[model samples]
Target: MQLNISRGPKATGKTVRLRQTAMKAGIKEKNILIGTSYPDRELEAKVLQLALRGLKVICIDECREEQLAFLRRVKDLICNSVTVHVVVAN
Candidate 1:
């Protein structure tokens, strides 16, 4: 199954809760990925690496209007791939 979650600050907890719930329901840690894009390049690399390792990728972007469209494109790419959950957080 695949899921794309978009959210603002309030939804931060929601994402974590969802991941935790999914894990408790039997999802492996390696199969669940969480991340944010506002950090530094090193962090981005780490997130990407983790996602590439076969986990879901949840990218958090805090209300960056210009990035919305770009993120949509990225979502499409992720949906077609075998890896990544591809979440976009505002």
Candidate 2:
């Protein structure tokens, strides 16, 4: 399980970098799980997840500094099978 953290200001293309990293890790678009703070976006991610199988490439966007613990928990939960990448826009 690999964990990559991409931190930068808004519009810095963090998400783009994350996608590239996931691809490099051999995870396809169909097997990616993207999570955000927004409820609607999360719903969309859930829908996307339903179409995939096996370990996922979990990308959490807009993560805040204080949410490191939460992110760690998520990482631990799927550490065995997934690669967790976090993107924080400061």
Candidate 3:
């Protein structure tokens, strides 16, 4: 698993940079999963499931603190060598 972080104030180019990284990684669009970092079980589960299904890149934009904690609890369980995690936050 690889982790890339984009942290800055709002209106910064964090999202753009992460997206560019994902694009440049040469993965297919369907192999790239974009999601939000809120405390939603369905959303969180989808992120993990798709990663397990072989997504090459994962993007979590605007992560909330609680959601970050939740993800941290399960990141190891879902992390794979071929996957890249791009985490964007303020």
Candidate 2: residue 47 Cα off by (Å): 14
Can you write out model 2's per-residue Cα lDDT over 4-76, one digit (the tens) per residue? 7788778878878877876887767654454445454443344335324554566656666555444454444
TM-score of model 3 vs. true structure = 0.68
- Runs of candidate 1 with Cα error greater than 4 angstroms are 1-3, 6-16, 19-22, 25-48, 57-68, 79-90
Maximum-lDDT candidate: 3
Better of 1 and 3 by TM-score: 3
lDDT of 3 by residue, 1-90 (tens): 555555678887776776676678765455445545245565567667767888766766665555555566566777556454555455
TM-score of each: 0.36, 0.53, 0.68
| Better candidate by lDDT, 1 or 3 | 3
All models: lDDT? 0.46, 0.58, 0.61
lDDT of 1: 0.46
Model 1 agreement with the true structure over 32-70: per-residue lDDT tens digits: 444434444443445445446665534342324444444
Q: Candidate 2 vs candidate 3: which has greater lDDT? A: 3
Clashes of 2: 0
Cα RMSD, each candidate: 5.5, 5.0, 3.0
